[model samples]
Target: MRSSSVLAIVVVLLVCLFKHGNSVPVEMETTTAMTTEFTATESSRKDIVFNSTEGEMEKPRYPHDGYCGHLEEACSDERRCCPDFECYHSEGRCIYLMQ
Candidate 1:
């Protein structure tokens, strides 16, 4: 019985080899880099605000404590700190709480 099972396994292996041994390797198509002209207008560039003191005071990117509070930044009861952060009133700064 064991010899017959071994013969059946050998037959299956031979069948698989015969089916896949004649398979051809497929050639992949080569990609070519295409160049395109990109023109950016002055108005479009003006929309982005950089690290300017005037711009930060006038228009803050994250209002109402939307962003994470830094160590030096001021935080109070009225102005809550970011997630997993607490307002250290003694130092008047926001601090990250460890889990």
Candidate 2:
């Protein structure tokens, strides 16, 4: 019937409006900040490429395993690594991502 068709159209319009209305603006702001920080960190890493020792460039040390190791689950949970790049600094080392 025509009533059922009109009801369906109203439901579709309501769903579309609700979907577009529910997003939080703060999330977009945070995402923008994260992107900016990432770009800066990448540029800084270029300096490490030239300044660090050959061994450091070849295989940076990790906090857990001494050489090129990933952070333990506990450490990662605590956000122990660097804010810009996840650094592993256990054995006098500062491990950062290449890019």
Candidate 3:
């Protein structure tokens, strides 16, 4: 009877361990998926563009102040910066100018 009890205890412990082990991998997968989604959102923010005619352009509130003087000017891939003059050219690094 004692041996049977010991065997049952061992089986229960084994089942609990197995379940815990499987749960860890599931949690890790969930975390990785969230990280990937956040990265994609951050990259898309950098590539945002606005129509010149919309007149909805606004200067970047952080990092560099004022409009970006040139395409080579310091710009954040996460924030929008207005063009110094007008947005006459095609799609580039320039943002729409504020009216």
Query: In terms of TM-score, which candidate is strongest?
Result: 1
Tell how far residue 79 is off in model 1, in angstroms: 1.3
| TM-score of each model, paired residue for residue | 0.42, 0.25, 0.26
lDDT of each: 0.66, 0.50, 0.53
Clash numbers, per candidate: 0, 0, 1
Q: Model 1 over residues 1-99: C-alpha lDDT tens digits?
A: 999999999999999998797685668988698688977677434433455765553322235554445556787766666545678989878888667
- Extract clashing residue pairs from model 3: 46-77
* Model 3 agreement with the true structure over 12-99: per-residue lDDT tens digits: 9999999999888543433434433445466346534454887775533334543343443434444334435333344434544557
Tell me the tens digit of each residue's lDDT in model 2 across 76-99.
333344334454545433355567
Q: What would you estimate as the lDDT of candidate 1?
A: 0.66
The lDDT leader among the candidates is: 1
Off by over 4 Å in 3: 26-99
